[model samples]
Target: MTAHGRLPVVYFPEADERLSSWAARMAPFYAMTVSEFVAALGLKGHDVFDLEWRLSEGQGALIAARTGLSPEAVQAMTFRELGAAARMMIARKSRSACPHCPEDLHRKAAAQPWRFRCKVHGVEFRDATGETLSDRFGADCFKKLEGHAEAGAAHLDAWACGAGQGDLKAPEVLQVLTARHRRASPPNVDEQPRMSLKDRRDYQDFLTTPILRQALTVVVPEYDQAAPVLAKPVRPGLHALAQGSLLQCFALTVGIGRIIEDPVKWAISVMLVSDAEGQGRVRQAISPWPLSLKRRISARFWRAERDERARQSAEKAARQRQSHKYRLIQSHKYRYRIS
Candidate 1:
């Protein structure tokens, strides 16, 4: 086999391996950049990262032919079957370090928000701080919150993967959680003021107020003692967060889980409290909740209103009957006195 041919060596794709990961791993072995490597494999017109989601049959066939991998194996590395929302959750690079994985070869689980463990190893991933969730959160926190964290992770996995078919939509739920609270105390930290202008990223936290962090405390009182932090304060959705920021992801999902379990209370306690500072910006998130949820909440209030009206009408009719009885009693007494 020539240097460029089906030649030298081939690496089979790892289980739950990312398309980019498989390609990147092979690229260095061949003394080619990832682009150069795939180009040599009779591939063109699509970026390697893009192929992580959109690898076509033709593209898969080209890769499978050269690498001795089945087309199914090639396709498994990509997330083409996942919906757009789920696809958006993919991290560009592995967010956490897995003890079991080879250096720099990220598994698909590493890039996915719904998973916090190394898929192959079944152990937790070490995040940027070089700490597992237990290391970062400490013994007490790890014990108490781990189950909640797992619950939240399962909620997101189900919602993102379309397995739950529940009323909660993760993005809309996050919108409510992160919505600015009208009555929240100034989030201005003293240290925040002293930071210099050149280090602009630090200022990003201040630009967006401390909403999710504070809101999560309500979701899980266990988090009340723990100070909340955000990688980037302004987030449009969970997918928009810095992928490796597992701390934020954990808190966000935990809050989402609690909200999913009880949306009305979440809306009243978390979303409604946000500043009506400007008309109904906060209310907007509450308003567009999937119709089933909105109806459930509305139905509860509607029943209360109907019950109150019925009670009032009953009281009024009783009062009229009592008045008539009193008048008849008075007339009978008057007639008896006359006789």
Candidate 2:
């Protein structure tokens, strides 16, 4: 545990663009046919999605049922069509937070409330839900549908795992070693200005402080529980360095593979290693954004920047009205002499 005995939050494995690229190469098929593939891969029974049987299986059925097509009908749909449907279905289900309270109200309100207040909680807020919630037809119905989903299960993990429930780990902060130490650059030459020898020594000592080591243990349970296959017991500092180095090597391999543009191989590596959560931590420590979000975010940012510029222009006009030039014009009384 950390010095304060808290564990770090972990995220589920992200779908990789590299893997998606490989999957995209599959021959085209109808949406129903693609649904069959999904069913087959997940070993789902045809009745698993039956409306009559839906309640027993719970909210997952809500997603499947939204298609209004039976599992068999879904199986008959084309892959290309199913691809669009699948995206809509997923985006539909992701929880929408209340525009007011932190609680997710599940896309209940459509137009900005009279004062842009959330109808449910009557407060103004913005988050993933508020941003992604559709402004179109689904906005109202989806809110009710999502409530049904929530009634079935409180969180994604619970929904996925089913009836024998338990709490999922919440996000926490823990200390970790500053494994890599680079030489301080000359004062004027680099971003990290030079530090004195004593300072460096003091920093090194801080890294080894007992509280920090405890934090590492708290954060990374795997380190305490799963002994690395190292031959000897190394100092905590050395251990951190070794683990960090391996993660760096794996990242480099990923980079090299990307440079070569080998999607299949990249997919294989990602799928194979995704289960090793500790390694995921190491990867995140080095580079936070994975490929999928990176690709999608660029598109989001383009639109966001465009909208921001529009907003700024409007605001600028208002500001100009308050300026001296505008004031002078407003204050000036022009006498129109009829010639």
Model 1 scores a C-alpha lDDT of 0.68
lDDT values of the candidates? Answer: 0.68, 0.29
Off by over 4 Å in 1: 1-5, 162-164, 183-214, 221-224, 228-234, 239-244, 271-275, 295-339
Using alpha carbons, what is the TM-score of model 2? Answer: 0.19
lDDT of 1 by residue, 1-339 (tens): 343357368888888888888888888887889998878777755689888788878888888888888999989998775677787687788877887878778777777765667878888877776777777668777667666667667777776677765777777777766665444443445324455676556666564554433344455554444443334233645643444267667667667777877887666555423444521555576676877777776666556557767989999999999999999999999999999
Candidate 2, residues 60-97, lDDT tens digits: the string is 33323532334433232212212221221222111233
lDDT of residue 115 for candidate 2:
15
Instruction: State which candidate has the highest TM-score.
Output: 1
Clashes of each: 4, 17
lDDT of 2 at 173: 8
| Cα RMSDs, all models | 11.6, 25.2
